[model samples]
Target chain A: MKAYLKKYGIRLLIVVFLVVGILAVGRSVRDGGAGLLSNVSGAIRTPFQKVATAVVSRMEELYGYVYKYDNLVQENERLRAQLADLENQIRANDQAMEENARLRELLNLQQKHTDYTFESAKVVSWNASNWDSSFTISKGSDSGLEKGDSVVTEYGVLVGTITEVGTSWSTVETVVDLDTNIGVLVGNEQVSGILEGDYTLMRSQYMKLSFVAETGQIITGDIVITSGAGGAYPQGLILGTVSSVHTEAAGQVEYAVVEPFTKLDELTQIFVIKDYQVVE
Target chain B: MFADVIDFKKLRLALVYILCLAVMMFFQDTVFARLGLFGVKMLFIPAACVAVSLFEGGFRGGLFGLLAGLLCDLSFPESTFLFTLLFPAIGFISGLAAEFWISHSFTAYMATAGFALLVTALCQMVRVIIVEPGSALTCLLTALVQTLWSLPMAAVSYTVIKRISRWGNKR
Candidate 1:
């Protein structure tokens, strides 16, 4: 036993040290491990992983089906009622046509004012962790969306920005994210301030509007728009409405809370703003 | 008949290992997930480490560790491959440590568990150094939480491994 222990002891130590050293070196490199090792590991693991993933996915699908059955029934009933209402509205078609024309004109006006080009993308997946407010969009390099591109909804409300862009998928760090900041202008007043996320709440609760002079003409209910200050976002896009204002004792500088217009949690579709001319 | 017995043994062991791995992964996905207070995830690594230490030895243990780490890495989509390498290294080192520094005593098992916890803590530190050097304090706090949580998991894994090894030897 002693001889066996003595023989293998140093060998085991060497192996441990070698692995630790390799890992440390691997950490420095962008790729964790070399090609063959990673590829082999990936290949060997993929099938088993896939099986496990499939099992979990199927279980989740079943759970979702069962859980949403009641909601589905409710939604179906609601939709049927709405469908009947729409049918009745179609019978009295003149008013419906007028309303559609009015909506088309408003949409056209919105399009004319906002020269920003949009690429529509679907939200494919969301991070399971509620604390990390990020989601993956289907659009990527192939769709002409790149990192640092601003994302918004059809109503032109700020959604988030593309932080990491892969070939087929990209991650959007929403306005709710603690690290996010947007340069915004308040309504027709043109009162500019920086909008930032609050980490503590874990929601898009309030934005910290900073660097506005205390003497600057600022008031509650001012509509905040993208100033195109930082070149990350385009000019004249609606961000939110100012909810509250904060004043320092010195009265030289002030801040305001801007409630974002986008209902971030319920977002299913978003437009990646593709072509914003940088001011700088 | 002899070859059949050998095949049966190998198949049984493989199945047992897979089942253990599945259980570990489920706990990691659910329980450690909830424990992510202030970026600190509870230590699931030690469970894999302890299991590897007791049931598997040498290259096999290392491989199992690598496998466990890879599975854990899939949960974090952002940092794609970094965790894959770091965690396997922890497992391999912990298993190696168990093989070398300690004898097969209750104390040794406890010591192995402690070593696994230390390894997990060190791995978190290494991650902090590589990924987010600025967030060392946060990582350190998280490491401490992970280490604390790993003790009981390691003990349980030790028991499971012991039982599995006994069952393996019987056939």
Candidate 2:
């Protein structure tokens, strides 16, 4: 019994220490893996990493043209790979810079619109189909967002409305989606109609303002804004501008093509107006 | 000291697979996801698994499929076990196809990959139908696009594995 205890006691002690060590490592890694990793690594290896990076860059540079004359194929391959990597980096950096600028503009808008209570969210994944139009956002009901909330760009351009809200994600159905229709006023005169998403018009990145009076004076370049009828949307949010005025060749109602202020394809981050004054 | 000169053929094979999967995952998420064509990004994980199955045979194919599927599950967590289950089965079937009827060549690899990818896409389409019924048509399009995009990847993966095997043989 004593021999068994002696052997097992030491083994148990070692096992306990091993488990403790593993747990410590795991805890640290879990805590510091993201966000803190770059900063911490920079603080520790900034000088060394820079030198190492420079040396590797120079080596790659040398490797590219090592046998420019004799091994042209190899050289081309290396250069092409290097170019692709650099281009990818440039794109990522460009996206980051653009997002930063957008956030700044959003902050400015937040300050300007004091009555607008807002939550910001990043556009994450897009729906796979070209027919339907909705994109997922990173923030959702947990961020006080609900279905039917008004979403806008930094320039106060109405992008879409939140249609579905989950705990951590939400879906925004854009103006070009076939299901969307907003009550809108045309030009400075407030000529009222419904700005509707037409499948045909959406292909050209435009929506249709339908049900205009057959005699209503509408022209090209006329600004369109939300009418905010029935308290569905806040008043006077910019919908778009009139691109062209037309009446269906066989139909009675006049309609104008509206070019949306927000380019739905180039979106990344958007603001959800949670609460706003219901100006009728 | 004599045993120190032990065989490392299996180790070398494992290393090749690990390296291949790592590079594929990086391209799948970081690079290809950013390269939006028609607002849809290509999926590299299925292509990678298919290539692995064609080259490595049934057991290794299944193993690699498990890894690939696990990574996929991390991003799209809705159906946690769907990819994990589907990928391994596809990989195993691909290995059978490779062993029986096909030679270890780029052309064979491309054909086998196309078959495996089509099967996987069909599975995904089915899943989408059951889960999000409204998106089924779009999912079919997505699956086809994913398969089409994966053809070139099969060529690349075959070349890479072939080179690695040649290097292994040389040593």
Candidate 3:
């Protein structure tokens, strides 16, 4: 045994060093820098990470070009069909202009919780791991992006939450991760439930809205929004639209399938809601 | 003169291996990060290691694999040193296969790449099974996509490494 150890001691040492490196990183993520090794590693890899993200951004631009062209082609076909409805619809809408304005006045947001200050970030890379839905954003602790800060779209739709932070980079775990569970409110009924990401539903780009009372009747296409009950997220941020609802065989518990408002896959740039007032 | 020749050869090998690892990491992290073609993230570095192992030796490939693993662990918090162990083993196996059966031909590239990609897909499958068993079906599809995407990259790596080796031999 001693002879074998002596022969392969260096190799064993390297392996130990590597395992130690990962543990340190896992520990340091909550606090920012892992130790000497993780810090050094993150620093050395920073430039490469930046370049990797930049390449993706450029590719997204190219993809957007192709996507837009495809959309144009599809739009042309749809327009050919919809041309008959367009003039009639426009005339109908023009007549309802006063009613539309009245509805807008009623639905106009007053920003009851206006304490939100945001930091814009460019998605630098995605989690290559198949097990989770996450990505790295360019801004980090330097931008006041703390772990648990909310991430969102330009339209203030909830995307994910920051889970890990470094000096210049932070990882955002999307709402579709099985580990994510947030208190949510649904529809005009004010139905309350725990919105959670499930491993199975993730493939379909959906999440589970569970833990509702049997008294609450949820219909298809009902909008889900953050309830702000746990103070983890601000209230009224759009989560998703109800796709399906399910009831247990015992009928004691119920859950609704939610499809996110934003296409998580197509998001290249997002905003970090660094600070927000917790509404009770 | 003999000692100098050996030293130069070792230096060349190290340089080539390091360069391949760096470039592969760059492409995988930056380019492949966002371009999820067909729901699979392209793993281009493994192909580089397989190419070098075929063109040079197993030890060089294993070393490159080690760095590649380290790069993954350091960059992505979710990835652990299990990657470090896996990549080296893959490198060793690819190198061994290259030493025994491969030549500087398209067939060799295909064989090496197919084997390497198979191993990578296996790891991903295991990841889905062990870590997130619920995602197995979707992960399988992703693994297939990743393997297909990596095939062409492996061919490119084989061609590039072959040229690099030719230069090293002349020098």
The prediction achieving the highest TM-score against the true structure is 3
Per-residue error at A117 for model 3, in Å?
3.2
lDDT of 2 by residue, B1-171 (tens): 745786688677788788878888767655665565555555656666766777668778889899888877654433468789988887888788879988877777777778777777777556446544655556677667777876776677777766765676677
Q: Ten residues in a row with the worst lDDT in model 2 chain A?
A: A125-134
What tens digits encode model 1's per-residue C-alpha lDDT throughout B61-85?
A: 6667767767755654444565567
In model 1 chain B, the worst 10-residue window by lDDT is B127-136
Question: Could you give candidate 3's per-residue lDDT for residues A160-222 as a string of tens digits?
Answer: 999999999999999988678999888899888988877678756789888985677787899
Score residue A47 of candidate 2 by CA lDDT: 90
- DockQ of all candidates, in order? 0.04, 0.03, 0.19
Candidate 1 lDDT over residue span A146-173, tens digit each: 8889888767788788988888889898
Residue A245 error for model 2, in Å?
7.1
lDDT rank order: 3, 2, 1
* RMSD to true structure for each model, in Å: 34.3, 26.7, 35.6
Give the interface RMSD of candidate 1: 5.9
Candidate 3, superposed: residue stretches over 4 Å from native:
A1-111, A127-131, A247-254, B1-9, B101-105, B130-132
DockQ of 1: 0.04
lDDT of 3 at B34: 64
Q: Compute fnat per model.
A: 0.02, 0.00, 0.29
Residue runs of model 1 more than 4 Å from their true location after superposition: A1-110, A129-131, A201-206, A213-221, A242-246, A252-258, A277-280, B1-82, B93-171
For candidate 2, the clash count comes to 0
